[model samples]
Target: MYPIIRMVKQMILHRNDPPLSAMGTHVSHHRCWPWDIDLWMELNNGRTLTLLDLGRIPLAHRIGLISVMRQKRWSMTMAGVSVRYRRRIRTFEKFEMRSRAVYWDDRFIYLEQTMWKQDGECANHALYRSAITDRDGIVPPAQVIEAMGADNTRLQAPEWVQGWIDAEAKRPWPPMQD
Candidate 1:
């Protein structure tokens, strides 16, 4: 069993969250795979952003910030997602991703993320909701949530996100179908 003292220490030290861009370096490219374009198209379509492509930049930043602030390990499970694409982003283009915490409920954390092209134009943006879970899928103790102030009750979908979702729903499924 995990020690209570260690849990308390982690809660106190790692709970201070930071913006995702502050944690790691930007990524420029991934080798061409047959599905690369499809994946990019999906991100642009606003359904859900794949975690794999989120990369170490955003992940390291968010995890590091949360660890530093809460002093504990935060295991995350994706709950929901929404994304918008402002411009076409290709496979080899250099890009940057920025993310910040939007809110947290007793059992969930929400984050707003944006991806930008080398020219600094918005390529895509997303709202990601995640739940905190243990390796065995157990929820964290109440004391941990209270210590982190993870009691937000005012979460709402942003206006731009609604628009993006609508637009994506209307997009042709297969490019050739249009």
Candidate 2:
């Protein structure tokens, strides 16, 4: 688990791009293979933790982004996803995964993720959104409010992530909106 965490940290640090095959199919890699289905089964019951794993990458990216920007009020969620498996990824295969922050406003954060094979083929991609909330999951934090102030510069996000954040911001949160 520590090793996996370290690998995740390294991936976030380098902002490495996903790898792919010559034909553009994503391949799996040794370091990230543990994040796949087979290993996920060993580590979890394949129910709740599966969902958590799906959200982990984007959440990690969100955390990294907040850290880089030196902001503390931003929050995120794994609001939605769509994952397609082209082939079974084995443990020994070398692969790469990359995630980028899509966007953020006063309400939510959006992110995009992709995994690829050594030859630079796309394996999986997902867009996710989470509502921005305070640490206790109640009101929006003041820091975030300040960060989104009128005079502040908007943060640049990747193409895939932009739409998601925009959509999430427009969507109403039931509890907060009421």
Best by lDDT: 1
Q: Considering summed lDDT, which 10 consecutive residues are worst modelled in model 2?
A: 19-28
What TM-score, over all chains together, does every model reach?
0.49, 0.48
Candidate 2: lDDT of 83?
A: 51
* lDDT tens digits, residue span 1-178, model 2: 3345654655555455443211122212333344543544322223222433433443353344334233665455455654545544345465565554455555554445565667778656656554555567733323443453422344666654665555656977774742
Superposition error at 159 for model 1 (Å): 7.5
lDDT of 1: 0.49
lDDT of 1 by residue, 1-178 (tens): 2234433443444345443333133332222222435544433332225432344223434444345334655555666676556777664455565555555445545567766767779777667665666555635434334544544234554566455445656877666642
For model 1, state the Cα shift of residue 116 in Å: 0.5
Give the alpha-carbon lDDT of every model: 0.49, 0.46
